[model samples]
Target: MTTDRTNWAGSFSYDARRVHAPRSEDELREIVAASTRVRALGSRHSFSQVANTDGDLVSLADLPRTVSVDAAGSTVTVAAGMRYGEVCRELHEHGFAMHNLGSLPHISMAGAVATATHGSGDGNASLASAVSALEMVTADGELVTVDRDADAERFGGMVVALGALGIVVRMTLDVVPTFEVRQDVYEGLALDTFEKNADEIFAGAYSVSLFTDFVAPTMTAWLKSRVDDVDPAGPDPDWMGARRAASAHHPVPGMSAESCTGQLGVPGPWYDRLPHFRLDFTPSNGAELQSEYLVPRAAAADALRALHGIGEHIAPVLQICELRTVAADEQWLSPAYRQDVVAFHFTWVRDAAAVMPVLKLMEQQLAPYYARPHWGKLFTHEPGHLRSLFPRLSDFRALRHELDPRGTFGNAFVDQHIG
Candidate 1:
């Protein structure tokens, strides 16, 4: 009984013969143990085929949505299927919050961590870096719990394993006391100004995002600053000649800003301001394709310059491009592993045929910079090329082999890119 299922962007339909949503952990373990091949499906936010399997696709959506905060330990254990939005609110109510959040709050916690999904912050690590522990149902139906403190050796590899090891049941993430954030959008920042003072511009706020079409003379800068971190008497609207937007503005040129988070430097909770989009509204351009390349922060200027040189070719298929910074982390497969990075993200018009050529060109231009593609986004990198990009690829493959000897979690995507 094949069911027609596609990801959030209505791209890459699943190849699984059946989809299951077990009501309990026992049922989930039984399903996993019985299947010859299996993959876990989250909120279907990924753009790639990483979650597709031929035999069965299991969704944790039906499992109990648990969110327990351990104040003493400064951590929160959330059900794998729970959305960040749901958990963040609960955490805030309990006087706690996750360190950061990706743009979309509706994405599943486990899926986000598994892909090393992240937000923009020079000081903030990928979402996976906050995982203190995680519980997974392995291929043989055994429940395994690994914590960073107890199993540091293997835990690093498991955080961003690309769903090849097992189905993540729950994750215990590090949390901090609730904090307030003020968001402001600066428009008309010239390309030269951005390139010249990139460091100061990014460090201007706790989390900063620059949105552009590559061909544009000026880009919009979305700056999210911690309220307490800023001095109240300091001069405001000092963004290197960029004018502050009087009203909220969407990243996409013509799209309505109604779905975006509050701006104009109004202080709000971390959950509300950290992510650009509001949880109640659709995130980004609903009809879009995304690709991101993470490069060493040192090569950021050269990478941006290279893109600027080919802006004409990119502007045709591009909806928008975002420049963000992420701190280094120890997650084995994380793009930001061991080095602070500048992420060049593209939100393209949803046309694979038209986007492929542009992606190839971008990849070629960025090859010298050693760019690593986002695990869940579209990319043209081959398995061999990817192996060269990630130093721990062999180790991750070994760990996968150890945990799933029969290859129960193996899928076409994993075989092609990970194996």
Candidate 2:
């Protein structure tokens, strides 16, 4: 093991005695067949230890890179290990694009799909919802395929199965014709103005994200509009009482906008404007911890009000807070399962001792909404209570056993919470 073998955030040190990098699927199967315990490792962007294991860890980065698009079918089959940014750029070059992307595109296909990672939009679903098929190595080191279009209850359970089903090796995602986007930033919007026009604000663009320090006198808005969907033109000098930004602005107040994607309504490829930060810059340099909760869409105003009451407690440690939306999806483990949701994401200073208490307080205030926490982020929710919120957890538990009967892939996180 190497001392440098820490997660991207450097906040979590893995327990794996070794990290194996195999160049071929055949070799990967051999390693899995030989090891008594194993887990697949991706880009390592996960904030929590959800993907960590005590025995052996497998990194697919060395595997052959693949990005094959079947233009006729409007789908792209990519190597699961490929980062979203790499894959999206390739797709765009081929005149295709994924419907949406997370706030950052550096995440791996398998890791992002497994965690139900999402982007902002009232019509867009979580990234996993775009996956039409999955190819994985089962517990017995044999390959198995699941097709969502052929449609099975099992497929819904497997899409966001938390890595307990199998080690995803390849994924086929639905794609669309290439498009351009322009991002417009609005500054100094009153909190009440946002609360009153929440739905209109999100609907104003293809994707919209509101950023605030929770205690700031005013908040910033990033509206990413599809060039074709909206007028390729620009918005007025003011939008719903918010002033148009004359220059670039970062999501976190006062930070260099150089690390962020272009703003001020400059149109660019879908891959460029869809995400907040540019792939060239590592977001926050792994110096921040994150937590997010997805609450029912109807409770948006209420949820915002609840958090506003705690701004004094939240302001000290908060780097920034983002409010985005995701349409309902059918993935069994997805936080938005069966209900549209508004996600409140918090980027906290990396001081766990100080942050943990505030997380508990936030959860308490959000308890009325029965908010579901993001599976891959740091959350203070009790394991049992957290699992209970997902109605299909029992079905997922059964699916886990069906795919990994001997529990070869069951880590502490899986066993303790996913049971």
Candidate 3:
């Protein structure tokens, strides 16, 4: 096993025996067919061992990066290893953009989609919702292509397959005409105001994100509005009892804004404004631990209150906490499946020993809401409870077994939770 390899966060070392970077799909197919077991490693952004394997790990970094845009079809096909930043820039040049992007654009498209990583907006769904087609090397080392139209029966399960089925190589995502967005930030919004008008506040812009410490009931709200849809000049100095910031601010308190995207109502390309961080720099306090739970929107008030009760204790090891909304989707294992959700995301100090107890307490508080943890983040949810949350768990297992009956692409993480 490689002792020198680690994830981006530098918190965990991979147990992979060897990592292969193939320059071509032909080579990838060969590696997959010859190996006893394998798993694809993208940017290694996940905090968990979701991407790790006891056997060989396949890396697509060496493959020739390709982006093919089908303007007429409203789709753009890209090498699965490409990051959202890379794809977005090229697409913007060609007058197109994806529906939404996560907080960091550096995440690989394949990894983000597989884990149901989502962006915030009352109307926007998770990133996987844009997947209409994909190509992957299955367990048998055969090339298989599937799309929504042709594979209606199984497409929902494919988009968020959790790296259990195969090593995806290329993905075709839905796109729209390029647009401009302006971001504005407001601070000290009262907890009561937010709870009473959560829906309206979220729907007030193209996208909205609220950041807090929980040590206090107040939080900051970031509103990103499409230029064509809202005033380019932006909100008043005092918006909803929160003062608009006069300068750019990083989501994490006390950090430099150099790495963050432009704010303060600056008009920029959708690709630039949709993500919280810029492509050139590392995202939010580089050394950090993350955990998120997506609970039904109806549970927002009580959920917030639960965390508020212990806010003082949470503020110590916490870097920051964020609240965002996601529209329901059909992805089989997505946290937001079939119900609109308010995602409570936590960026914690890197000490896992200090974070675990607090994390479990937070989970217990939200358990009554049936909160579903993000697949790629740190969580202690047991196998059965997790399986009960996703109605299509059995179907996803059937699909995975059909593609990899021998568990060629499976890992301990997938087996523990899925089996």
Candidate 4:
């Protein structure tokens, strides 16, 4: 099929000559080998041009949506095009679940893995960490399979490749027994109190998120705690100086809470509670731009202070800013690689012209903390500076060249930021 397409946020219009959806692996391979320039498109959730290409944009939507659970091995293999919500339901029905999930369940499995997307938790690693093995179609139309146990070195460089490698077809992810979770939203959390008890606040739940406009006197906190792991009575009335919301809340202020998951400390299935938004509803502000920076946990306090200092400048184009934590992982290109990190995510009003300057200022202010930008979000950092932030960047580039010798997957986004 052929048509002009824009990303989910409508921030970018793909410039691909054609869009192709293959019905089978054989057809996908043929399209990959014949195209001069190509990139895999998944869910179109990204705000950046990472998935853009001048030749052809290949969508795996037509591929069979298959999920096979290896009960004995405690793993589930799924098609790359399948969304997390779709896979999570199947796993829950079979008495299994993934270790973690991002804020939106509508994101495609392969896309989330490729970008090292994550949820908020002190112990939980990025989504890519759960992947034990994956299958991809390389530039030469050759199918390649790599597993963490057998191809440790190469697998580390491939998981968060920013689509500089190849088109992933299937992935085998680790699974655990299904469990229940309860979510609570607290309002009026002062910046001073949060700074003093950040650790204690985040430790209060399995996953914690803070939302703010930066200039506000207080921020909103969303806490998701496992039913079996935490207190049965639920969170306290006065949680670190913040009071529980009397009703459900959307992350963005004044918006209807209709799209949000069950709140008010009600117990529900893990798949329903983990993600902030329900699968059937649009996630976050419908028209928005996002940018996130992950700084080492050690620099959390300092990073928050720096951003607060520039609140006046950022408040104009901002919709809401979220702060979450991510544990360290071994993936070479992951933003949280090798260190526990606190991510400051911005959901900005969709005005690229005004937001770009603020983003550049953020990178400058947080440079001392060695902040790394999320691969799929909008960022203004130069390749040289970003290379310095990631110690294994050179190794990843070498792996990219080896797998895609002709740079079939390379685009302006990859060439400018990764090459």
The per-residue C-alpha lDDT of model 4 at residue 112 equals 91
Candidate 2 colliding pairs: none
TM-score of each: 0.97, 0.97, 0.97, 0.98
lDDT measured at residue 181 in model 1 versus the true structure, 0 to 100: 93
How far in Å is the alpha carbon of 414 misplaced in model 3?
0.2
Q: Give the top-scoring candidate (lDDT).
A: 4
Question: Candidate 3 — which residues are off by over 4 angstroms?
Answer: 1-4, 282-285
Worst 10 residues of 2 by lDDT: 1-10
Stretches of model 4 off by over 4 angstroms after superposition: 1-4, 282-285
Assess the local accuracy of residue 390 in candidate 4 as a C-alpha lDDT between 0 and 100.
89
Clashing pairs in 4: none
Tens digit of per-residue lDDT, candidate 1, span 1-419: 11338888886778889999899999999999899999999888888788888889999988988999999989999998899999999999999988999988889898999899999998999999999888999998899998898997888899898999999999999999999999888889998898888888888789999999977798899989899998775337656888888888888988888987888888999999998888988664268899999999988888999987778889999999999999999998999999999999999999999998888999999999999999999999876679999999889989999989999999988988878
Instruction: Output the lDDT of residue 128, model 3.
Output: 97
Q: Rate the local accuracy (lDDT) of all candidates.
A: 0.89, 0.88, 0.89, 0.90
User: Native-vs-model 2 lDDT?
Assistant: 0.88
Angstrom error of the Cα, residue 350, model 1: value is 0.5
Tell me the lDDT of model 4 at 387. Answer: 88
For candidate 2, lDDT tens digit of each residue in 225-249?
Answer: 8888775457777998899999998
Tell me the lDDT of model 1 at 209: 95
In terms of lDDT, the poorest run of 10 residues in model 4 is 1-10
